[model samples]
Target: MSQQDRIPCFLLAAGRGERMRPLTDDLPKPLLKIQNKSLLEWHLGALRKAGIQDVVINHAWLGEKIEHALGNGSQFGLHIQYSPEGTALETAGGIAKALPLLKPEDYFMVINGDVFSPNLPINNILAKVAIFRAASNKPLAHLLMVPNPVQHPEGDFFLEDSQISALNLGAGEKLTFSGIGLYHKDLFKDLAIGVPAKLAPLLIAAMEQNKVSGEKYVGPWHDVGTPQRLQELNAAYE
Candidate 1:
């Protein structure tokens, strides 16, 4: 794909994975295996299938191992770049630090490297990029909302006719942020590079202004946060 047509993707893999304990003691969570392939590998394959050639992965804990494992991504038909953080920057901070590599685009796709969503609807999101760009309000982000998993029963935000809002407003059903999204670079303009910040506050701020849009995805999605869940997925995949 041409440069303009190529939507750069940033994979957020820098978390400490404190909950994963000994499994994460030596290996970063993204490198954890599922069905004989690394979790990050699954994302790489999916992105490549969606025609996303340019990818940036941020890593902190056991970051070098990730670099060693993926190399230049040639094997996967992708151009992979690393944004190494001294410490695991929260989601927003990691993306902000990687902005230089992802620049020259009004928006880009970001996915949480730790999660697994085999059918992420990347093509649909790319199709909406043009629509979002031309919108009068110029929304800064478009999120993928999924049915709330048992782990997060309260859910995160409510979606009404594709417009996302922080308040339920007694409207559409509340869903969980799937950690898969299309984000405008302008959303992080105010953040200082290298400093840590969470993405939720930024998303919430935009939601209040009606500057965020989202769609509900009912698909096989898994947040492999704990070793038990990982084992369960491995068994199911087996």
Candidate 2:
């Protein structure tokens, strides 16, 4: 398949960034800067380099600023569309609602707005998810994992033999979610569109069927959620 035919994607930027507090009280997390550029811009530029042409960004808090800033994505050489959220719909539900904007590919990509990870391997991640989808009758989602970073030392999920298991259950070491993943649309078929939903439950559900795949990334990455972490990230680039 051609690059465009492989799959299209959406950037998950609609969160209110409640944890970041006063910093995000006025600006959305995706609009915050590191090395003089917004997190969204870095991801867009990276996605463009990986040959993705179309992008859909959903936003709520201070969302207009995102539109005003990235306007149509021409600056980054990608076609852009917006799904303005009157109220944030969390992660899975946000993707569910934006289904119409996505192409009829086997799967699509999602990256959390508050993160700054190394250039992602979008094609490889999709390849792995396709392998899962072929073996299971149900939908599949492939998550990228990174070694537990400082802020979330407890970590979030666990991996064994390329399959991911949720941390809420039995004994297993936790690995950070890495804010990067690929999801087949069928994963959200049972969800009500435009409703609030987190990706955790769905991830666990996929884990039960042994349908979720993951890879641990030992590269440059950071969850730039707070002002302190953002400052550290900026300093490293300088």
Candidate 3:
């Protein structure tokens, strides 16, 4: 496929952002402002800059606000579509429900609504997907990792030879999930439609098969999980 044809779109603005409480009590986490713009706006702006034209955003809590904020996406010069969930479906469920909106491509990208990261290279993600598809017999899902934050330093997974795995908890090195990833729909091929589920077990299943790939992002990344961290992030950027 041509490079342009190889570009995959994304899933955005879906999570409950529970950790970002109080602030999220009145507004969805994606609407939280930083430098006078909502976090979702920041992501949309970046996606626009990266030449991505199609996007899928799912929402539950205060979802209409999202539609109000980004109607039709023409304002952003993109074709944005909404997959409204009356109740927040956890990550996997949301993705499973939104699959029809995605193209029948090799893989698609997913980004957490609450994460803050420096501009990522979309081409880099496409490259990873291609490499994994060519190399392994297993299905491909490339996750991005970041260094553990002080608040939860134990972190989520360990990386060995471009793969992600659960820690031994006794002799494990810690690295945090960056909340950005490339996923092929085949990862959910066997999932029953409209069912609610989390991505943890699915991810662990992929890891067990050695199908998961990862890269450490040493660039700027913030969890922005609470009012305090939101304030801290806002102050840092100021």
Stretches of candidate 3 above 4 Å error?
Answer: 1-6, 136-138, 167-172
Candidate 1 local lDDT, residue 174: 94
List the global CA lDDT of all models.
Answer: 0.92, 0.82, 0.79
lDDT string for model 3 (78-161, tens) is 888889987767888888888888664767888887788756665577666656556757455788888899887889898876
For each candidate, how many residue pairs have backbone atoms clashing (under 3 Å)? 0, 0, 0
Candidate achieving higher lDDT, 1 or 2:
1
For candidate 1, write residues 1-238 as lDDT tens digits: 5666778999999988999998999999999999989999999999999999899999999999999999999999999999999987799999999989876378899999999887778999989888977789998999999999999999999999998998987677899999999999999999999999999999999988889999999988999999999999999888
Clash list (residue pairs), candidate 2: none
Model 1's alpha-carbon lDDT is: 0.92
lDDT, model 1, position 105: 71
Ranking by lDDT: 1, 2, 3
In model 1, the number of clashes is: 0
Highest-scoring model, lDDT? 1
Write one digit per residue (lDDT tens) for candidate 2, span 191-229.
998888888898888888877777888878888878888
Off by over 4 Å in 1: none
- How far out, in Å, is residue 56 in model 3? 0.1
